[model samples]
Target: MKKRVGLILLLFSVFLVPANPNPVVAQDGKDREYYETRGDIVWEVPTDKKVIALTFDDGPDPTYTPQIAELLKQYHARATFFVVGSRVNSFPEVARLLANEQHELANHTYTHPDMRRISPGKLAQEVAKTQETIYEVTGAKPQLFRPPGGYYSESIVNIAKRAGALVIMWSWHQDTRDWSDPGVKKIVNKVLKNARNGDIVLFHDYGGNRKQTVQALKEILPELQSRGYQFVTVSELMNHYGTKKVGQGN
Candidate 1:
């Protein structure tokens, strides 16, 4: 009789346990591992088509931002700008202009902290503020987040994922390193020499004298176009490569 009563209690506890058991939270671990094993983050889309994404960081600069927009328009290319929150507040019109021109305006966090060193709460604030600012200014919610300096942690990735963003890093080979004010020829060569299908080339529209970046684009855009390559926003590149599952924006 005592054994029968204990078995009943055990069955009762099992029935009381919640089914589904927070599936989203349960999957977060798997998702986090998926991102980490892919070279710190989604550096490049996996594809064989002659397509690539040109991403700019640290801006919406009053001067260079507009100049970069014009250059993109001229070349009939589309790129993504990972913008800082404070700068977005300072230059909503620039953000709007990029959105208006069909260029993607994504989050680069507020104040641009090295995300690996910050707490998850601080990281969330950085990303949330940027997302709020961008949405307020452009009426488009950003689906992509690029941590400042390309530094990330598992916590960073989970925070971004929970906030509805996919962390975007860039191909090591395709990085222009334009923030160093590299000369136009060097910047141009870095991209043209190592260019490939599904490559995400990093450039900067702000954070210093970006005259070289502007000039490099003038050469890079046309040369890539001539080579039968098409420039795309990060989202479009992901779409072509099927990096994210359908209906799964992350």
Candidate 2:
């Protein structure tokens, strides 16, 4: 009787677990070892060095990209811009200016679609087209790619890797959300309060009126500089200081 009861309990436990294999059900990197190759997915690198990576997305905007680039210059800061392929084609001069200013140009897909919802072939095309576009305008091939909205899967990462770019995700605590047109003060406070060593802060250049971002940068740059934090591109942060094995921002 005891043996039969133990067998029945084991069978019941097996039935209780869900059979769906997608890691989206549990994103905690437990079964993610296979996908986390060579620090391909990065949220923020871990280091004691006072270096931070500021990443801007969805750009090549005629108005805002130039303005942001100027502010970065004023601060003697370097950042990575994840330029959309379509935007690069539309504003090739703006794209060139970013590369010229010593900023790193990373890929952010051609149309910024939800990678999880698209077929694997379409996702591959998005990454390939952006690489070609960035190289065409800047004469530099990007080594990093940020998926639209930070959404990813094994397939997306694999495709990006095949394109020879690691996936770059920003620090969760440092998201400024300036694309939503949040008040300039709010944007400034979010970045200032949460800025940390080896953090990758997210900002946007194209989704909307980016004046708040410009205004906040006006505040953020001077203050972070005062704190003795050096701004470096994403690649520099990873290659120079080394990356944390498991990254957040899925």
Candidate 3:
């Protein structure tokens, strides 16, 4: 009886020991060398210049997306747009414009549901559907994905990964409340005050009113440009740092 009790406790102890926390695991050891050489799929930019990746979410909105794209073109800069599937359908022309203007078209889900609150099937649908629409419009599959309202879960990230996207989260951003018309100057100053190199800046395109948001970008981009910051797509910024590409697994 004593021996059995000791064995049971030892088994429990073994189970209690925590496993390593690695996001990606290579099934074959030989694959690691290749993946290591290829590098990470996505990464935060690590630089000293006042460089930042401007990313717009929930877009292809007829009202704001075209205007924003034109502003980016005028400044000779690039940005990432995480577009919604439904919006893409409603405004296919706008979708084409984003592609034509050389903006990064990324995934923002089909219906723009709060990604953290949905079932895995629903989440996967949201991600995969948007990816399909983006590819359909641009002939370029999205490499980056951002959740609606920046709310996400591990399941969301995993599903997005399976859809062949790297989860993109901004490193520096404050709630612009642009939907509320928080005044153009306030939004511009907010971005400028917290700006940094290798930082991902978040703004909205659809969802709600974005007039102030558009106005803000007009002000902020030139100021940042004058300061010598070159805006690029999210992938460009990540590659400028270092990206570790591992085998694909959900």
Candidate 4:
């Protein structure tokens, strides 16, 4: 009878083991390892419709945000802004403006910390705090999260996933290096050479003077228009072209 009881207890413990304990899940039918590592960085757009997402990171600066917003309005284009939480407090109106204009306000962390180096608790706090700040300022919880410097690990994805954010990375980088004030011509050349359909382009709204980057976007938008490209926000692009996973956008 003791041996029988031991067998039952062992079976019970097996039932207690958690299912899907792995921190990452690749929902699009791709191998989880492929999607988890380099794949999450989004090196390319992976489609052919001239649909591209223009995403700006590290933003809501008083000096640059308004200017970029006005330029986007000029082209009747939509973009996503991955904003820092502390900056939201510094320039709340920019958050309101992005919402009013229908651009996405995504989480980029509270102080732009290197997310990979931080503890999971701090990472959760960063994501949670920013989500709250975004909703407080914009009245909507952002569904996406972009790490500072495009850094992510399995643990980062796990923390963000637990916080109910989809990890968003970019494809088709324009690489303006706008932080260094690279000339508009260089920025334009990067996009002109690389711009493609279903691509997500990365730019910055804050971190330094972004005048050349702004000028480059003005040029790139019209030029791409002539080439027959349509601008969409990141979520729209994913929905329209990217492989949809169940439970996504739920």
Candidate 5:
């Protein structure tokens, strides 16, 4: 009876635990070689020039996007907006405004699912649909793609590569964490303290009470400008760094 009870408990435990607890599916081993030869995820550019890329995610928010755009315009700075497909559809004019103002409109997926667990076909659709939406609205296909929530697997990178987008990740040092709405002072301190050349600072124009972000930028932008930093889009940062691939170093 004791052995039988122990065996039953073992069986029950097996059922409780998942085969892959982490949702991100692992790609085939051989595919790594193939993807390695292709593009890589860019964090920051590799240059000595005082240039940085400012990227905003989850927008084209009708209210905050215009304010952010106006701020960028006021600072004479450029930024990259990784927009969601559904938002672009909802606000086509705002999407057009992003492109028209010389800000880049990159893909952030259609529904913004965590790409790690999604099947390749579903992932392809997510990326392709956003690509199509952005192209239709902006007349330009984005060369950059940022995985939702910055969760990436080999499979996710493969899908973005197949769709002709280089995956973009931000430097660990520069993440503003504005999504948490940590107040304007914390957000300002985060970027201004770590400001450096080839840094890609992340911000959000949408996704919630971005008035704090707008306010933080008002302080961060001019301070950085006074310190001689030039704000450029992500692609331009990659070009400046001569980064040809995404996961090259990893």
Candidate 6:
């Protein structure tokens, strides 16, 4: 009776769980080359000039987003915005303005689900939906895709590539952690102290209570400018530095 009940519960759980899209490939003796060259991951580039990509994630918020954009404008810098598709629908005008201001509008996701492990079908849907939304609302489809919370697998990268996006990650040392509302000085230091010529510094525009991010930016923009850093969108920076492939090393 005990064994029978265990079997019954196992079967019930099987019915509820979905299969992983990229099942474990046997590493013993097959398809080793494809395994070696699978996913696209761009964290930073290698350029000699003082140019970097400043990227904002989880945005299109009515409040903080516009303020950040204004700050960027004051510095005459252009940055990329990784926006949630649903928020774009909620505030299409804000998105339109980002595009009009010449900021790159990239895909964060439709609902910002953790993309670390997801089925191929669901991942494809999330990528396609956000691509469509950005194109539909702003008249330009996004080419850069960053996984929610930086949680992405090799399969997730390939899936995003299939949807016509280059997976974007930030520089190893430039993550501000401003989403946690770390003190304004800390956010300022994270970027200013770690600024580099091919660094991709991460910030957020739409997460809760980003006044610290906003405040940090006011200081960051001016200080970085004074230090001779030219800010450009992810795509533009990539173009400037020949980022035709992802994951260029310093």
Q: Note the Cα lDDT for every prediction shown.
A: 0.83, 0.86, 0.74, 0.77, 0.83, 0.82
TM-score of each: 0.83, 0.84, 0.78, 0.81, 0.83, 0.82
Residues 85-141 of candidate 5 have per-residue lDDT tens digits of 999999999999989899998989998886656777997998999999999998998
lDDT of 3 by residue, 64-114 (tens): 888898899899999988888888888999999988988888888889885
* Model 6: pairs clashing at backbone N, Cα or C within 3 Å: none
For candidate 4, what is the TM-score?
Answer: 0.81
After superposition, which runs of candidate 6 have C-alpha atoms over 4 Å from their true positions? 1-39, 243-250
TM-score of model 5 (CA atoms)? 0.83
Error of 6 at 250 (Å): 21
lDDT of 1 by residue, 1-250 (tens): 9999999999999998844311222323454346646533577877888898999999989999899899899978899999999999999899999999999988899898854367789989989989899999999999898888766566777788877888888887887889988799999999999999989999999988999999898898899999999888998888666456311644
* Candidate 2, residue 41: lDDT: 73
The predicted structure with the larger TM-score, 2 or 6, is: 2
Per-residue alpha-carbon lDDT of model 2 for 1-250, expressed as tens digits?
9999999999999999853322341343433344445455777888999999999999989999999999999999999999999999999999999999999999999998865577889989999999999999999989888888777666777788788888888887888878778799999999999988999999999997899999999999999999999999998898788644212222
Runs in model 2 lying further than 4 Å from the true structure: 1-38, 243-250
User: lDDT order of candidates, best first?
Assistant: 2, 1, 5, 6, 4, 3
**How far in Å is the alpha carbon of 211 misplaced in model 1?**
0.4
Best candidate, TM-score = 2
What are the per-residue Cα lDDT tens digits for candidate 6 across 1-250?
A: 9999999999999998845422333423333234334435667777998998999999899999999999999999999999999999899999999999999999888998855456668878988999999999999978888888775555666777787888787886898888878799999998988888989999999779999999999999988889899998888777777445433321
Clashing residue pairs in candidate 3 (N, C-alpha, C atoms within 3 angstroms): 39-243, 39-244, 39-245, 40-243, 40-244, 40-245
Cα RMSD of predicted structure 5? 6.3
Top candidate by lDDT:
2
Looking at model 5, the pairs that clash are: 39-246, 40-245, 40-246, 40-247, 41-246, 41-247
Question: Comparing candidate 3 with candidate 6, which one achieves the higher TM-score?
Answer: 6
